[model samples]
Target: MERRPAPSRGTAVRATRQGDAVSAALAETDAFTSAQDLHARLRAQGAAVGLTTVYRHLQVLADRGEVDMIRRDDGETVYRRCASDDHHHHLVCRSCGRTVEIAGPEIEAWTAKVANAEGFVDVVHTVEIYGTCTICAARPAT
Candidate 1:
């Protein structure tokens, strides 16, 4: 099992029941899920969390780096509990919202080289590759 760092002080200090439920839901999945999907799942499980509350909790998690947020090809945002604290990129399935975490030493080197060339310091970046998965690609076109 992977170990996650404890939340810093002043952020997520008190985990409300709703927040706990939301976190539990997120912990159950590795795929990227939208707020609406999470809300529906919680409702199905008899959790008394509203959609707005789910969105709020997800935002808090993202802000604290506990979860990763990425925009889909359709421009909808999705959230997933981060698997690691280390820097990584994601390959996302546009159809099913599945995600694969990847590390690229070459990409990191390139980013640093570009930053230095542009006279930029303290650079940060996000990379998300979106495409159809095998299942989605194999299906007949709609």
Candidate 2:
């Protein structure tokens, strides 16, 4: 497969077959997945896309806020298609990798209050909460 140079940050990434394939593969799963994993899945589905291409597409999507990424405890970044374009937080299941998007009005207010108290300007933030879900917690002792 021919390779294209990686798109620069904030560059407008036009749609292509490979990029569409990557996004389609991501939409098939609700779990956040690694680039290698997504590449494998694309191959399994007979999509002619490479791992590097997967990474690049994911990076572009993430830059556009079209995807959500999380760094696990081990430091691997995983990507998932965004459910909402609006600002929100994620509650991730540590055991199953399930994610739920949520808004925190109180947290937003608190962030504003704290930042204002310090006279901070142009504040931006992200919040992610990780824990085992009820199903994962209910399984019999392994």
The TM-score leader among the candidates is: 2
RMSD of each: 4.0, 3.4
Tens-digit lDDT track for model 2 on 1-142? 4444434563455678999899888998878888999999899989999888899899987876778888888999999896788888888898888888889888899999999999998999988899988999999978
User: Positional deviation of 30 in candidate 2, in angstroms?
Assistant: 2.0
* Cα distance off (Å), candidate 2, residue 134: 1.3
Model 2 quality (TM-score): 0.88
- Show pairs that collide, candidate 2: none
- Per-model clash counts, in order, read 0, 0
